[model samples]
Target: MKKSDVLEQIRKIGLVPVLRAESESQALALAGAIADGGVTCMEVTMTVPGALKVMARLAKERPEILLGAGTVLDAETAKECVGEGATFIVSPAFDEKTVSYCRAHEIAVLPGALTPTEVIRAWDAGADVVKIFPASAMGGAKYLKSLKAPLPNIEMIPTGGVSLATAHEFLDAGAYALGVGADLVDTKAIRGGHPETVTAHARKYMEIVKGFQAGCLI
Candidate 1:
């Protein structure tokens, strides 16, 4: 898919589930559960065992769903993930090299930043979108709103503290999309043989995003 289309789909969907699993099977299970609930995009973090294998399999098995590689720290890892069919690359922190690589390769890159300085630097460096990591620690939606005050043109994905309760608030605060972790992915639910639990969470989140988007429609 074109890089522009990938980003547009992300904003249209308005939810990016961040997946962290114990094993490849668990990751696949989580993806299936999320997809079943109407969410087709996810970030498979490098922390999971066999992360590359998981991405590869998902890319091949679930071609309809958009796949991204998360916790990508450097250019080399980003390149490998792209090779494995990651259309987008997400990182917990900004890496100049990684941003450059993505730009050169025509891939969407979301590099994480916290303060205004870091966020602007990443935006100026050509990040497709800036991810506000650990957003809850700095004040969640309020902080995101503050950042949007001056940087209204920058597209941002708030990566932490997003949940069924706060998802609407984050969108109201100008989040282009949300980067959700345990709240939506639910590793315990999947690992404990309760994939349905994760599916339920996905449905609720999808509802939240859908409602918010519907309200925004004019």
Candidate 2:
């Protein structure tokens, strides 16, 4: 997909599920469950065992899903993930070389940032979107709102504290999209043979996103 199109889908969907699993098989199962629940875009964190294998399989088997690589700390790792079919690169913190590489490759990059300075630095470094990592630590939606006030031109994806309970608040804070982890991914439920639990969570989040977007349209 074109870089522009990938970013458009992200904003349209308004939710990016962050996937992390203990095993490759479990990761696949979690991905399947999330897709079944109506979320087709996700960030597969490198922390998962056999992360490249998982990304390859997902890219080959599920062409409809938008796959991204997360926890990418360096350009080398980002290159490897892209080779495995990651359309986007996501890092927990800003790395100039990694961001530069993605930009040079025409791939979407969302590097994480927290403070105002880091956020600006990431944006200035050409990040398509700055991900506010561990957003809960800085007061969640309120913090995001503060960032958006002056940096309104910069897009941001708030991660680490988004839940069904707070997704709406994040959207209201002018977040470009949400980065949801355990709350929506639900690996435990998948391991317990309840993939439906994940699907249900996806449905709930989708409902929130769709509802918010619909309101915006009106």
Candidate 3:
């Protein structure tokens, strides 16, 4: 997908399920389940074993899904993930070199930032979006609201501590989108052969997103 289009889809869905699995096969199963639940976008964190292989398989087999890589730490790792078919890259810390490389390659990149300074720095370096990592630690949606006040032009995706209960709050706080893990991916559910749990969470979150965007909810 085109870089801009990828970003558009992300905001439209309003959720990116952060899939981190213990095994490649489990990761694929969980990702496939999420897609089946009607949310086709996911960030497969590099922490998963054989993550690149998982990305390659999904890219080739599930071309319709918007698959990306997460937990990318450096330029070299970012390059390798993109080569393996990651349409986007997410890092826990902002690395100018990686951000610049993604900008040059036309791949969407969401580099992590905690403070307003880091957020702007990443944006200036060409990040498509600044991921506020460990977001809840710094105050979750309330913190995001504070950042949005002055940095209204910058897009922020609040990761960590995002759940169905708080997804609406995040969007209401002006988050571009949310990078959700346990609440949506639910590792234990997947491990127990209950992908249904993942799907249920996706469906519920999607409904909330739709409601929020339509202004049907506060």
The candidate, 2 or 3, that scores higher on lDDT is 2
**Model 1 agreement with the true structure over 30-100: per-residue lDDT tens digits:** 99999989899999999999999999999999987899999999999999999999999999999999999
As for model 2, its CA RMSD to the true structure in angstroms is: 0.6
Candidate 3 residue-wise lDDT, 1-218, digit = tens: 79999999998888888999989989998998888888888999999999999999999998878888999999899999999999899999999999988988899999999999999999998999999998999999999999999999999999988998899899989999889998888788888989998888788988888888888445
Global Cα lDDT for candidate 2: 0.95
Full-model lDDT for every candidate: 0.94, 0.95, 0.91
Please name the candidate that would achieve the greatest lDDT relative to the true structure: 2
- Clashing residue pairs in candidate 2 (N, C-alpha, C atoms within 3 angstroms): none
Query: Which candidate model has the greater TM-score, 1 or 3?
Result: 1
Steric clash pairs (candidate 3): none
TM-scores for all candidates: the values are 0.99, 0.99, 0.97
Candidate 2 lDDT trough over 10 residues, lowest sum: 182-191
Off by over 4 Å in 2: none
